[model samples]
Target: MSEGLSTRILDHIVHLSPPGTLEDSADAFRKLGFTVTPGGTHADGQTANALIIFADGTYLELLHFTHAPPASTAHPWAHKPPGWIDYAFLGNAGTPSVADTINRRAAADGSGVRYAPEVRGGRTRADDGRVLEWLITAPAPSEGNGTRASARGRLPFFCGDVTPREWRVPLEPRSNAEHASKARGVAYVKLLVLPSELDAYAKELTSVLGVSPAASSASQVVWELERQPSDSQPYQAPTLVLNAAEEYEEEIYVRERGAGIYELGVAVEDAGKAGVAYTPYGRVVWQAIGSR
Candidate 1:
């Protein structure tokens, strides 16, 4: 398997809310100066979402379940709380499938990172009745202590579009991208992990993302995702920061909820002008470019 298959793009980050709370979450983000677009219910009729699109083809997905499916259905959103949940990476459209390649490579490298078989997924646009489709690969379920572990909020999933990307992301009406707070795009995602699990999770991330952790200290590690250069753009890539929970005095999500996405760093035109509101779900950190 060729390296770097998983680093093609950072597709989207997911934030889950309580059942029937999609609009509330969107309202909160709107107050934060984001343009939130209404998304439709999934084909399964179990969940729905709203989107916050960025210029770099990345987005923030605010997801909430409409109703609980039957007990026989095996979806993961049945009992999850509101917070920054899972995230996805864009997969390549070429050659051997990204999911298969990652699984094979993990086996070869002894990384123990395994993905479930690819599955078809789709949603109907509530605004236009248009249907959008895609293929998704998620982590395989594991069992421990006589209980099945959930990959919902903890693991990264892979998505490859079956429909045209443009159809899913419309370009007309450029005003939708504009924000009152001057926010641009995601700067980084902060994940909290226990110190004992840092080395193992770091190895798994290196195998899955095809990027080694760039800077590491006793309390944190950072990985830089791949980004294409544009003539009008400066040099920078969205990052993933894994912080150790034990080193901090304040409580982290991993301490209250579990080891998963703790916060998000959003890039804005000016950090001083940006204001952050703590929604019921997760924390959003607004920072200027090149600021620590």
Candidate 2:
């Protein structure tokens, strides 16, 4: 495997809800046995969120618009209907930024991958009046001026924090990481791509992750993640799975939301609680994978 980008650690996955449903969404997740933490409004003031943090440091961000939708169709969340909208990889602002590193690798390999310039973003904590900031870099349109790629959510965006990451993702009070449903952390994320686009997306993801797929077939590609060790229990490394949207449900999903993350798999401990659950925000497919 190529030494992937240093910033490839899974950060968090975003679950978007309809306008003004932040609190409702949070409450719904709590009922599902998660511990939801209050996340204040974004610097933009139009969005706010709550977080369901996991033992392994990855989290589920339950978010919603605070007011009317932005008028611009170019906005990431503009016209986006509630569901799993995006996911992020931890990143940094350094000599060779995450975006620069990935783009450089793509250039070297003749893969035309381009991430937009990093944008500054932050939010205040609702529990405490603290401010946290970060830089975001997402896939951008390739002008065809390059070697050969283009797409979105099929790959993760990068989020590099300006403030202490702990302040932004507090893992203290161990109970916060303990869910009644026994979910330990993200197990895998599955994206549904049009059959014709699978090959291109596989290349796009390989370029972004800086590593080749651990397993692949004509219909699916899998990249196994090396997870951060948990304090309470050892975890099986997570996996990122991309496959063609040929099933009826998958086809419908692509028609409705295009190619993007449609489901999340979380590692859980209780067999009784192991199953699938659909929420207004997103679909969760969990399993009873005991500690390693």
Candidate 3:
């Protein structure tokens, strides 16, 4: 795994839509005031995406498959519905990959959070026709009597760039990082869990990230993931909030999406801009960061 707390840093969260709705999804985000950058097709050619890049080097990937009944049944997104399907952690390009380190830790603690071998994945940028590649280390299916399967949607996978990181996530032109909504970067991602599953999920997350909760209560757990400070922008540590479903809407969301991300929090400049905004598939909450 990565050194120290680097393993816990948030990379990006994925927002998926129904098939053939890539442009519609981008349009929807644009209407919500985010600057949507057109992304290219995946190596498999079955998926395409658009990105909302933040100055903090994190982003929201809006993706959809080219075919409704994706040509391959084994496709990860084939059966997933449109919403906050998954999230990823920034992987390290060093000895002992994220998968190996996490698997070793899990084996030692019996947390059973095994990760599959890193797989090469990339996409051709629709904007400039450049191919960007990365190594993905995702959760492995449960083994024998292991409960590794329980960590699927709840835990994050890893993404290590093979190509230059800037090539995959461009932040030049200044305007690319400027959102009309005044949203700066990800503030936190909230995951709603069934009350009974809260503890189990929290433990799995701890195992995967090699970090303990920053704060915790009987009903909720929080991890404040630190990001590399930007030279021109103020530093903001993104968070992961895991709470038991309590509200009527939250209950329904957990029922439908299971124990996965359902809400996104964005950091904005003005308090007046702080509020909730609904996208076609997910909910975003605007939070004022006060001064700077």
The Cα local distance difference test for each model comes to 0.74, 0.81, 0.83
- Stretches of candidate 2 above 4 Å error? 1-5, 143-152, 229-233, 290-292
Which model is ahead, 1 or 3, in terms of lDDT?
3
lDDT of 1 at 262: 83
The sequence of per-residue lDDT tens digits that candidate 3 reaches over residues 1-292 is 4455367778899999999998999999999999998789999988899999998788999999888763557766577778888998888554467888888878887786788888889999998899998998888876556542445567888888888888877888778889999888888999989999898888878888787899999999998886843424564678899999998989988997678898999988777987899889889999988532
Every model's TM-score: 0.90, 0.91, 0.93
- lDDT-superior candidate, 1 or 2: 2
For model 2, state the Cα shift of residue 76 in Å: 1.1
Give the lDDT of residue 58 in candidate 2. Answer: 88
Which residue pairs in candidate 3 have backbone atoms (N, alpha carbon, C) closer than 3 angstroms, thus clashing?
none
Q: How do the candidates rank by lDDT, highest first?
A: 3, 2, 1
| Candidate 3 local lDDT, residue 259 | 87
- The alpha-carbon root-mean-square deviation between model 2 and the true structure, to one decimal in Å, is 3.0
Clashes per candidate, residues 3 or more apart or on different chains = 0, 0, 0
Instruction: Indicate the worst ten consecutive residues by lDDT in candidate 3.
Output: 143-152
